[model samples]
Target: MKKMMQRDSTWAGIFLLPNLICFLLFVLIPIVSAFVLSFMQWDMLSTPKFIGFDNYIRLFTQDEIFIQVLVNTLIFTACSVPMVIIASLLIAMALNQQILGKKFYRVLIFLPVISSNVVVSVMWKWLLVPDYGFVNYFLSWFGIAGPNWLTDANWSMFSIIFVFVWKNIGYYMLIFLAGLQGIPNSYYEAVEMDGGNAWHKFRNITIPLLSPTTFFVTVMVVIGSFQVFDIVMLMTEGGPGRSTSVMVHYLYQQAFRYFDMGYATAISYILFIIVLILTFLQFRFNKSENWSS
Candidate 1:
């Protein structure tokens, strides 16, 4: 038995070895290096010098732009996350119903999710151009001139939020669709026998059962909102003077554009810590809800 167990362990390790090596090389090692580098000041061309907590101090206390970036990130999260959740949930519910061309609608909604974010952003950038763009041109039919979507600071962030929600709704819709489909029809029949109507069926059966999926989707949307960068980069490049500049985009600017590797790494860790705390709090809420129910 011991010899057989040892042989099984050996086979398991052989199967895991390739993935383990890749994780260490690509994920674990880079994470550790980033953590260490967060404590040092380096511009990639110079020797790294240990600076302890100065990077963090400068971030919170001394850096004015960092404060704006943080606020922008929060605003983006606040606006985009809820919009994505509500719109996707409603659309998912609609798509879940038995309707003509439901399959075609599902495919249409999901097409954007599978497409490249870069290409989508580029296409949106052209479409949203204030002058001679399709969006503004359409608005002109009603004698309304559209605001400068990317160049106006007031509208830039809104444009980002709108585009982000539009691009991401499909992915969340699929998740909700699966959750809806997983719910058995027997529950609805029971509700019907009890003289409950559509609202009662939805409230009593669908909502309660779909709580887990909703919770999961909420958490994912929050994390994705915080980590968003590519769309912001391609759409506005954090332009209109840092109005739509989120943490990750600013971190990229700091690390690669300005060569402030240490500062960027520190920002990255801060982002990680923020995300970690949010995730923990979400889990705590879910646990409490479960216990209460």
Candidate 2:
């Protein structure tokens, strides 16, 4: 019996060894390296100099562009996260019903979620071109002038937010659908027996039961919105004079364009801290809510 137990333990360690090694090499090491890099002044070509908190201080005090980028990222998160959650929840509820062609509708909605971000950004850029693009041209037919989407300062961020929310809705909708399906039908039946209407079922039962899924989606959407870069980079390149500049794009500029690796890493750590705090708050609130309920 002892020999067989020892054999099983050996096999378990053997199986876990490769994954453990890979995690250390790829994840843990890189994170530590980046943290060390954040405190140094290195321009890739030069020897790194220990700078302590100067890079972080400069981000808050000296770099005005960083402040704007921070605002842009916050705005993107605030707008896109709620829109994605609400829109996806509504779609999920509708699709959860026994409607005709529901499977096809689900497939159609999910198509954009699986599509390449690069391809979508380029396609939308072409479609939104001011003078000769499909969107503006269609608007012209209705006597409505379409604004220059990628170029106009006011519209550029809005365009990115709209696209981000649209692409993400389908993914969150599926998650919500899973949550909705998990909710026992017996609960709804009991509600009906008590003379509760559709609104009552949704308000009293569905909302509370779906809280976990909603919290997950909210955290993910907030993080994803904060880290949005590819589409913004491809579409507007954080251009039209910083109207659509987000943190990651600005970090990319600092790292690659200027070779300020240390400054860029500092920005990355700041972002990490912000996300960590937000996630911690979410977990705390969720625990409290669950306990109270």
Candidate 3:
């Protein structure tokens, strides 16, 4: 029995060894090194010097731009997350219904999500140009003058939010569609027998059952929003007076542009904490809802 158990353990270890080695070499080591580096000061060309928590202390207390970046990140995530999630759910509901051209509509919506963010941002920059852009041209008919989107502090973040929502809705819509389909038809039949309308059916039967999916979507969206960079970089470069400067973009600027490795790593850890807290809140809410139900 002992010999057979040893053989089984050996096989299991062999099967897991490759992935475990890769993870340790690629992920765990780097993450741990970054964490350690966060507490030290280094310029890329010099030896790192231990700085304790001074980087974090400065960020929280003395760094005005850091505060602005944090505020912008929070606002961007706050505005875009709910809009994208709800929009995706609605799209999913519509697409999941028995309608003609359902497959085509799904494909059309999903294409942009998988497309390159830089490419989309560049295309939108042209499309939103004040005078010759297609969107402004259409708006000109209404006699309401269009502002410079990427260059105007007032409109820059909003413009980015709109782009983010437009690009991401399709992906989440597909997720929601899967969730909707996973729901049993028997629930709908029971609701029908109870004289439920579409609204009633969705509220009572669909939303409750779809809570798990919603929770998952919420977590992913929040995490993605925290890390948003490409679109901002391509669209505005965190310009228009830094109004659209998200945390990650600010981190990039600090590290590469300003050569502040210690500060950049500190900013990264701040973002890490924010994401961790948001994830915890999402799961806590889900757990509470589950228990209540």
Candidate 4:
């Protein structure tokens, strides 16, 4: 028996070795390197000089742009997370009904999610052009002159938020759809027999039952919103006077454009910390809500 158990353990180890190695090489090592790099000052071309906490101090106290970028990230996360969650949930509910061409509708909605970010950004940029853009042209019919979405600081952040929500809504909708499907129909039937309306059923049955999925989606959306880089970069280039300058985009600029690898690493760590704190709060809220219910 002992010999057989040992053989089983050996086989399990053999099967897991490749994945463990990959995780170490790709994830663990990079994380550790970034942590170490955060304390040093190196511009890719020079040897790293250890300057403990100076990068962090400067980031927090001295760097005005960093503060602005941090605020921008928080605003983006705040606005985008709730909008995506609500929109996804509503769409998921609509899609859950026995409507015609449901699968086709799902495909249409999900196409943006699967499309390349660059392509989406470019398409949206064309659509949002000030004079000849489709969006502005449509607005012109109503005599509402659309602002320059990409060029104006006041509208740039909102434009990015709109695109982000549009691009990712389908993915979150699918998640909500799966959650909705997992819910047994018997609950709804019971609610129906008890003289409950659609709102009542949703509030009492769907919302409570789908809390776990909602929590997961919320956490994911928050994290993803904080890391919003590609869309902003490709669309606005964090321009219009740094209106849409998110943390990751700023980090990329620091690391590559300015060659301030150490400072960029520090910025990355700050983002990690922010995400960790927010995720922890979400879990705490989830636990409290579960207990309360």
Candidate 5:
């Protein structure tokens, strides 16, 4: 029996080898290399020189732009995540209500999520133009002056946040809709037996049952928000005056534009740390739910 088990294990290892090789070559090797590279100073033209913690030390203490980029990234994520979650939740609930043309509405909303971010950003850049754009043109009727949505220092982040939220709502809404459907009809029936109204049903029954879906959406949205770059590049280029520069964009600038490989790797690790902390916090909250169950 022991020899047979060993034979089976060997065959299993043989079958897994291809996938393991691919993982090592593509994912694991790059990650390990990046970790090592973070401690070395290098330009594309020169040999890498070991610099220890100098790169990280400069990122925290000596780099003003890095600090600004961190702040901008945090603010953008903070503003965008909740807005996307709430908006998507509301839209999902409405769409799930057996309304007319529900399929059409779902497709329309989801189109933006599937569309190219570059194309959307370019189109919106025109629509958000200070004078001739359709947005400001419409605001003219209300006697309210619409600031340059993409170009103004004060409004650049807000404009991008609004567009980002709009673009993501459809995708997240589908996830929420699936969750809403998973909720058994029996739960609502039980609530009705107790004379629970809509608010009570949502507060006590919907929220608790939907917490798992919320957790999933939060994690995905947070990860995507942290990596926001393409839209910023296409729309504002981290201007007017770096008002819209997120962390990933700054990393791109450092690594590609400035050819500062060590500093870029340091910033990437900082992002990794931030993401790790947030993920841990989410799991901590999730564990409470598990314990209660």
Candidate 6:
């Protein structure tokens, strides 16, 4: 028995070794290296010089653009997260009904989730082109002139937020759909016997049961919002004068464009910390809710 157990353990270890090595090399090592790089001034070519806390100090105290980018990130997250959650939930509920061609509708909605971000951004860029774009053209028919979505500073951030929500809502909707399906129909029947309306059933049963899925979607959306880069880069390039400059985009510019690898790494760490804190808070809130319930 002992010999057989040892053989089983050996085979398990052999199967897991490749994945463990990849995780260490790709994820763990890079994370450690980035943390080390955050404290030193290295431009990718020169030998790293110890900068102590200068990078962090400058980012907080002197970098005016960093402050703007931070605010932009917060605004993006705040606007997009709630919208995504609400939209996804509503869509999921709608699709959960016994409607015609429900599967087809789900497939169409989820298509964008699988589409490449670069392609989505580029497509939206063309769609939102000031005068010639389909969006503005459609608005023109209603005699309402559309604002420059990607060009105007005031509208650029909102445009990106809109695109972000539209592109990613499908993913969250699928999650919510699964949550909705997992809920037993007995709850609804019980509510019906109690003379509960749709609103009461949703408020009393669906929302509570779906809290776990909501929490998961909220955390993911918040993290993705903070790391928003590809769409911003492809659509606006952090422009109409830095209106859409997000943390990741700014980090990319610092590291790749300006060649300030250390500063970029520091920015990356700040992003990591911010995301970690937010995610922790979400979990804490979920725990408290569970206890209260």
What's each prediction's TM-score? 0.97, 0.97, 0.96, 0.98, 0.94, 0.98
Candidate 4, residues 3-41, lDDT tens digits: the string is: 999999999999999999999999999999999999999
The weakest ten consecutive residues by lDDT in model 3 span 284-293
Using lDDT as the measure, name the better of candidate 2 and candidate 5.
2
lDDT of each: 0.95, 0.95, 0.94, 0.96, 0.94, 0.96
Q: Any runs in candidate 1 off by more than 4 Å, and if so which?
A: none
- By descending TM-score, how would the candidates be arranged? 6, 4, 1, 2, 3, 5
**Better model by lDDT: candidate 1 vs candidate 5:** 1
Name model 2 segments beyond 4 Å from true. none
Residues 195-219 of candidate 6: C-alpha lDDT, one tens digit per residue: 9999989999999999999999999
Model 3 C-alpha RMSD vs. true structure (Å) is: 1.3
**lDDT tens per residue, model 1, 1-293:** 99999999999999999999999999999999999999999999999999999999999999999999999999999999999999998999999999999999999998889999998999999999899899999999999989999999989999999989999999999999999999999999999999999999889998899999999999999999999999999999998898999999999999999999999999999999999999999999999999999
TM-score: which candidate is best?
Answer: 6
Candidate 3 regions exceeding 4 Å error are 1-5
Model 5 off-target regions past 4 Å?
1-15
What is candidate 5's lDDT per residue for 188-242, written digit by digit as tens?
A: 9999999999998899888999999999999999999999999999999999888
Model 4, runs deviating above 4 Å: none
